[model samples]
Target: MTSPSFNPYHEWLGIDPSISAPDHYQLIGVPRDEQNPETISRAADAAMSRVRQVRPGDKSQEWARVLDELREAKSCLTNQGR
Candidate 1:
């Protein structure tokens, strides 16, 4: 049985259990309190780096969705209102 915290989407996105959530910041593994563009960029890059290693296989669609979410997260967080 899967753990209560085990989410296939989060697993596919390479998001650690401790940082997993529906929000953009959590999706990118960046703290929501952080507002610096450079810091967010670095964190997004690191998070994407981990996610990019996933071989799509049967989950290609899901993988693509997560990648899109990461991109959106980066865009949103880098914007002023974040």
Candidate 2:
């Protein structure tokens, strides 16, 4: 039998599977109304680091995509003009 699939968003980030597409704030573990760039950056960095640490070696592509999503979230939340 094949092994079960891994969902980093749910398993690693604790995001609900129902949320197929979590927003930038949700992805970064910040309040939706948070307006501090430093907080947003720090949250994003921590999330990225966490993902990097627990990433499965066989799932490099999936982890890369997650990292990209984290980067995009950080950019969108921190820039405020993007």
Candidate 3:
């Protein structure tokens, strides 16, 4: 029998699937109105580090996508204008 599917978001990041699409704040584990760049940066870095530990094996592409999302979240949250 095949193994059950793995969801990095839920299993690794503790993100709920019901979120469907998490905003930058949600993805980085920050408050929606968080304004401190340092806080955002720290949260993003921690999230990226955690995701990097996941050994997806055949799901390398999905792992890359999650990493990209974390990168984008950091960029968006740390942008002064955003």
Candidate 4:
């Protein structure tokens, strides 16, 4: 079992969401001290690359899951109103 705050999405992105953050930016690798679009973009790109490596077959379900998480993180990070 995992803690409620243990987001596998963070793991997939090689980030730890539990890290101290002034806000939610750390969930996707952005620094709490500063919001950088470039940094968020890089994080999203890395997640995308990781999910893309999952070829179709036995891991199709995992691929779908990771892809969904990647999209979610990207949407939150890129949406200025968020």
Say which candidate scores most in TM-score: 3
lDDT by residue (1-82, candidate 3, tens digit) is 2135566677668888666567788888899989999999999999999989888777787789889999999987799795
lDDT of 1 by residue, 10-66 (tens): 576555656645788777767778989999988888777777887767667666777
Residue-level lDDT of model 4, residues 21-80, one tens digit each, is 223354445665545667787877776787576554654665576676666766776776
Return whichever of 1 and 3 wins on lDDT.
3
lDDT: which is higher, 1 or 4? Answer: 1
Clashes of 2: 0
Can you rank all candidates by TM-score, best first?
Answer: 3, 2, 1, 4
Worst 10 residues of 1 by lDDT: 1-10
> Per-prediction TM-score, please?
0.75, 0.84, 0.85, 0.54
TM-score of 3: 0.85
lDDT-based ranking:
2, 3, 1, 4
| lDDT (tens digit, per residue) of candidate 2 on 1-82 | 2135556688668888777678899898999999999999999999999898883777777778889999999998899965
* Candidate 4 Cα lDDT to native: 0.59
Kindly indicate the candidate among 1 and 2 with the higher lDDT. Answer: 2
Task: Write down the lDDT of every candidate, Cα atoms only.
Answer: 0.74, 0.85, 0.83, 0.59
Q: List ranges where model 3 is wrong by over 4 Å.
A: 1-6
In candidate 2, which residue ranges exceed 4 Å CA deviation? 1-5
